[model samples]
Target: MEALGGLPEEAVVNSHVLQFYFHQALAAYRAGRNRDFRQFRDVMQALLVRPLEKDHIMARRLRLMQFLSRVEEGENLDCTFDKESDLTPLESAIGVLELIHTEFAVTQETMETLREMVKEAAVIVCIRNREFEKAAEIVKRHIGKEPKSQVSLCWNERQLLEHCLVCPMGCWGTEVPGVVSGMSYRVGSMTPEGVRGFLEKHAH
Candidate 1:
């Protein structure tokens, strides 16, 4: 297969040849060969331009490999991708999650790792599109099973929603009372009557 790398561009664009490289890439990734995996990844990226189909296993695998490669390269999976393509990263990740659930009968640990990667990709896509509330929900639903300390991100859903509500301009550090402190402090800081009076006074 190494010899194929020297072939001319026209020859490499054949779907059969691209599929061969896709399988090779998948094998290298699964075998934990980082160098070989990257070599084949570049080949697929260069030659494969067809849209992915969810029901096609090889196509799905190639798309998964491409997504993971972007992630491994520290590229944002959220903002990139052809807008006219059939699947966005978020949609592709969801399809991958469904495939993992129904098609493969893997163990719990392996299942969790696959699910986390797809969910993380989805959340990052939401965040990049300025869908903070949706992103927070995705994080909570898919990735927030562990305790707060075990969760990777520093902020929780409430914190994220609060930031989205109050900081439209994206200045996160500015101090505001109820908004910053969150709803947990609402009862402690103001009585029912006081809250009503405050709202009435501000009503216009």
Candidate 2:
């Protein structure tokens, strides 16, 4: 209690509240009260699904989907840490897919289901992106126009270069075919980094 006193009041209150609630439930369980258990179970279910609606959780889920897609692509996604990427979420997923690719070594016929999972995940990310855009628009209307400095993504040369060199799918490089160009071929060569380099090299 003494140590926690300096912490945020909400954190302290939440901790003590949960602790007291758990104790009450334990006491109820010992007394054979079914209602307390049911309530606890309901609360647990809400906790489980609540985080799934968060942006970071959606990003993780999308990354996993990307990993599964690479398996479908028949690419050797795994290498014991390349000096290439800084290991963002997407890169970490690619690493996992690489492991799967190494272990299973996909054949032409083995990739059908994995391809479908990739498509589904892409759709999910697109939907999430739309939701975020709508939310941003609402906030923008009410809060007065946002500053250009706060925008995390806006397609431009320097921004593109920064994302491509470090981003997992290389940002717009390899992923353009499926979502951007509407062409789906097993392509890992045109990574975002590769595209950025191409532009920079040609800009001269």
Candidate 3:
């Protein structure tokens, strides 16, 4: 492998060496060996940063792996790290989505789905961080300005948007004061017709 590193750029890019490193990284992650995982991740990332064909399967796979790794890191920080020092995982996740969108030639449907997933995840993270305004902005951006006409959302996406619009401080409000009032107002604003519009728009 060390000798392979000295090879010409074209030869290296065409080789299976990166795939081998990716598998090693994945194995380390699965086995819960943090040190080994980091080492392998670094190796794979280094290779991935080089110029590769956009349509290359290995390149796509590596991008997906890196995205998942960032998501996992974010989740781990959310659960175990100190709030004061831990970086925002959602931010990293969103960044990966942006990179994939701009650099890859994925199908339109796949791109839209990826965008929706990222927005949903970002909403959850912002809510947890008590950044309600940012959460609202994310939902609005994805749903569009004229949700009734332009935004066709699935049931799950609708529910997530609704939750983002109304949920305060990420709490579902189990008997908290003012919870019922706030929730009721938001729910009332969402009519059956509105939901029908969303469902119909996304049905295709």
Which candidate has the top score in TM-score?
A: 3
lDDT of each: 0.49, 0.35, 0.53
lDDT (10s digit) by residue, model 3, range 52-99: 434466656666565646644543435422346433554555566677
RMSD of each: 17.1, 21.1, 10.7
Model 2 over residues 1-204: C-alpha lDDT tens digits? Answer: 323436555545544444444445334433445467446534533434332223443333333333423322222233323466633222344455445444443543334333333332322232233322322222333212434443323243223323333442433556443433332322232222322232232221
TM-score of each: 0.41, 0.20, 0.47
Tens digits of per-residue lDDT, candidate 1, 1-204, equal: 322556554554465666787767656644556678789888777765653222455545554564445434322334434457534445454554465456444456655554554555555445445555655566656666655543444354336544654554445554434333342322112222432232233211
- Candidate 1 lands at a TM-score of 0.41
Q: Give the candidate number with the greatest lDDT.
A: 3
Least lDDT summed over 10 consecutive residues: which range in candidate 2?
195-204
Off by over 4 Å in 1: 1-20, 23-91, 121-134, 137-152, 155-158, 161-171, 175-204
Which residue pairs of candidate 2 clash?
Answer: 77-98, 78-98
lDDT of 1: 0.49
lDDT of 3 at 200: 31
